[model samples]
Target: MNLNSIHNVYFIGIGGIGMSALARYFVANGKLVAGYDKTPSEITDSLRALGVEVHFEDAVSSIPKSCLNSESTLVVYTPAIPQGHLEFEYFKNNNFKILKRSQILGLITENTFCLAVAGTHGKTTTSSILGHLLNECDVPLTAFLGGICENYNSNLILNGTEVSVVEADEFDRSFLTLSPDLACITSMDADHLDIYGDASELKKSFVDFSKRVKPNGKLFVRNGLPIDGITYGIEDDSDYSVQNIKIENGSYVFDVKTPKTLLENLQFNLPGRHNLSNALIALAMAVEYGCPHRQLANALASFKGVKRRFTYQIKTDNFVYIDDYAHHPEEINAVHQAVREMYPNKKVLAVFQPHLFSRTRDFIDDFAKSLSQFDELLLLDIYPARELPIEGVTSAWLLSKIANKNKQLVSKQDLLKKIHESNAQIVLTIGAGDIGEEVKHIKKEFNVAN
Candidate 1:
């Protein structure tokens, strides 16, 4: 089970965000890395640029010959990969040591001083912020993030061997595999109902993750979540709180109050109150890790956000375009609040692509309510990532529940023409599926219009 003895690492679903991050980590550590993905993507292209061998075909023959040794080569696969996947079955039949993505992450982080971020939403942004904070402070840290960080332009950040930062994902009970020295639960909203039947089971998973923290370690939670941890919130009486908030020139200027003292004049360029709370938790965790106060403040000030998390594609006075990976009701609500607060009185149009059939079925009412806040809505069909189609779940069915009169279900082919016809001042493309791949095209169309 020793990683040091492995000479090669192969991934069955290599194009995934988390899987790509681990691929980068193994390659950076001087191990030969290769993988098979169902499709080639920007992530796969980036890995190839880094000298990792990646192939699109999922057959066993697609695997490199160098990875044939069962003892020296370790195989990793994501939960999204099906049981009948050819490469996966090949690896299993050969008796090679195989691990799930989460299990491998748990193994890699076992000996390091780990800072794990867990939540139904905000796990990626929170972990990325913590990674950037630690990196800016020059801490001896390594971070395996769930998204591409805009600051480093990579999901894996390696600084030193002393500490590690990870996004504790809750899908399929993934976060339970992690043993963290310092952990935070950013939210406990009901999600992934296909995996955990109801909200109570989801909350129990978070509680279980909290218990996985080292006995002497600390856990940070949002003020209202049902968990025992140091609380963080904005303008609230939490252990670590953000107060004196002001928005000047589209940036948040706030002060953080910790148990010992108040850190004054904290500046975060990211929009929304949710991001402010994200920053506060990151700051508190950095301080707990012994990062200097001034260093933490400086890091927060210079921190750039993660890609697809409230990412600004085109920001101008006349027109604003944002892309966010908001797939859940609560996340969509956060995006709505952020957009409305930043550009009051401006006409806003939202284009959302539902992620999964089960999720859409479980929270159709909630999604309808959250999406109704938009001035205009463009709904796309559901993006079924890993689930079979639910009998009654469809984007049109969900769209029918929306109270907004200005809503229409559009195809991807007509998306650009629809946007061209709209006069909305602010446009947001929100989802956690292939909708993101359309951001560049949408931005190009906007640029041409200008």
Candidate 2:
């Protein structure tokens, strides 16, 4: 449990966003870091560039010999790794110290003034904003984010360690492990049904997370959530609210009404009202943490946003392409709203890859309704991340349920051709899966044509 005594750190699924952040933290702390991932990715490549050993195979021999010592080495594994992974088995049977990702995160932040952001959605964006705000205010902070922040171009923001900001993930009820000094719940939508089984249980998990805040700590909640806390919302009478919203030159210009005073003409460059809410809560938390309001305003405007959360790959007057990590139905609807609001007269072509089979099956009707809003749709096969496919839960089946006659199921190979055939002015690649890998190619092809 004493992290300072550990000399080496090994990760089982080091390529994951969260795991990679931890790996970077260890590397920055001068640890001998090594790990195994099922596949090589941009993350693994970056880790290797930092001189951490990484391999793709699951064999126990792939582990560095330095990481074999039980006393000096700490082994970390994500829940997504299969139970029978050879490296995992070897570490367990050899009496090595093993910890889940969340446990390690909890231990790292427990002593610091921790700021945790929890929700089914908006965790990454909200935490990233908070981290940027605190860092800009010259707080000694280390933030472990769920996604790479565009401003920093890194998931682990290590300015100093006096304050820690983290995404309090609710996936295995993971956020329960951290006692935060300041925490916020951006939303409590029904999600991760594969783990929680139902919506009420998921709500209960958020409530439990709220209690994990220290007795002297503050908790912030989205205005409409069931929990009682300092509330934030857009264009409403919450404890903290935004009013007089206007979009000029594609950036939101608004005035904030805090519990104490009116802060006017704040600017945020992110697109959606969801993002506006995210920025609001981060501002509220920072203000309560004693950050100067003037510095917080500047930080909010300078935040470029987390990668793949509504990233624009191509933007021209005649054509546009956007990539986003929107897997949930609510997330997709938010993307739809942002796109429609930005380009009201343009025809949008949405290329979507459904993420998990269980999620797709559970929310098929909702997905259909959300995707139906697009002018044209190209549906790819469901990306089965950790589960085997359910019997009838294919993208083709989901396509059939969509009310839009312009929708078709397409293969990745044919995807570009199908996209080129469409006359829509706006293009979006939406998913949390491997669809992100296709962004560079799409951007390159479209940019050349334009």
Candidate 3:
């Protein structure tokens, strides 16, 4: 089970954000790396550019000759990949040493000084910020993030093994695999009802993840989260709190009070109060880990943020365009609050693509209420990431529940035209699906039309 003994690393779903990060990690360490994904993306293309051979097919013949060695090569796959996958089955039938992506990650970070960020939302931003802060403060660490970091342009942040940062993913209960040196649970909202079946089970899972922190390690939880830990929030009584908040030149300027001291006049460029909370937890964890105060503040200012988390695609005096990876009701609510706070009177048009049928069914009412807050709404059919369409679950069905008069369900083909027809000054493309793939076209069309 020693990673040092393996010379070749094969991934069944290499193009996934988390999987690609691991693939990059292996390639950097002088190991032969290759894998398969269901489709090609910028991520996959980047992996190939790094000398990792990636194929899109699911055939057994697609497996490389180098990876066929059962002893020297490690097989890693994401839980999202089906069990019936040809390469997966071949690996199992041959008695190959196969592991889930999380298992491999846990093995890598188990003995390191691990800082894990766990949540239904904000994990990427919080972890990415913490990684950036630590690296900027001259801490030697490796971070495996779930989204592309705009500053680094890679999900894998490479340094030394003395410290490591990771996204403690909750899906498939993956975060439980790691025993972290320090951890944060940002918000334990009800999600993955497909897996947990209800809210109480999801809360229990967070509690389980909380206990995975090392014996002497610290745990940080959001102010209202149902757990016992060091708490953080904005303008609230908590272990770490942000106060004296103000917006200067479109960025948030705030102060954080920790248990020991009040860190004042912190500057963060991201757009929401929720993001401010994310920064606070990152600051608290970094300081608790012994990062210097002045250096941590400097890095927090320079941190660009994770792509697709309230990412501003285009920002101008007369027009504003945002694309966010908010697939849940609570996340969309955060987006709504941010946009309304930033552009008070401007008309906003939201184009949303629900991510999964099960989620859509579970939070149909909440989604309707949040999406209705926009000035105009354009919804696409649900993006079925890993689930088949559920009976009676459809975008049109959800759209009908919205009380907005300006709402309509639009196909991807006609989406640009609909955007052109809308008079909203702010345009948002919100989802956690292939809707992101359309951003290039939307931006190009906007440039051409303007």
lDDT at residue 234 of model 2 (Cα atoms)? 91
What lDDT is reached at residue 369 by model 2? 95
Per residue, candidate 3 scores C-alpha lDDT tens digits across 194-214 of 999999998999999999999
Give each model a TM-score.
Answer: 0.99, 0.99, 0.99
- Candidate 1, residues 141-165, lDDT tens digits: the string is 8899999999999999999878999
For residue 438, model 2's alpha carbon misses the true position, in angstroms, by 0.3
What's the CA error at residue 221 for candidate 1, in Å? Answer: 1.3
The runs of at least 3 residues in candidate 1 whose Cα sits more than 4 Å from the true structure, single-residue gaps closed, are: none
lDDT: which is higher, 2 or 3? Answer: 2
Model 3 worst lDDT run, 10 consecutive residues? 441-450
Worst 10 residues of 1 by lDDT: 54-63
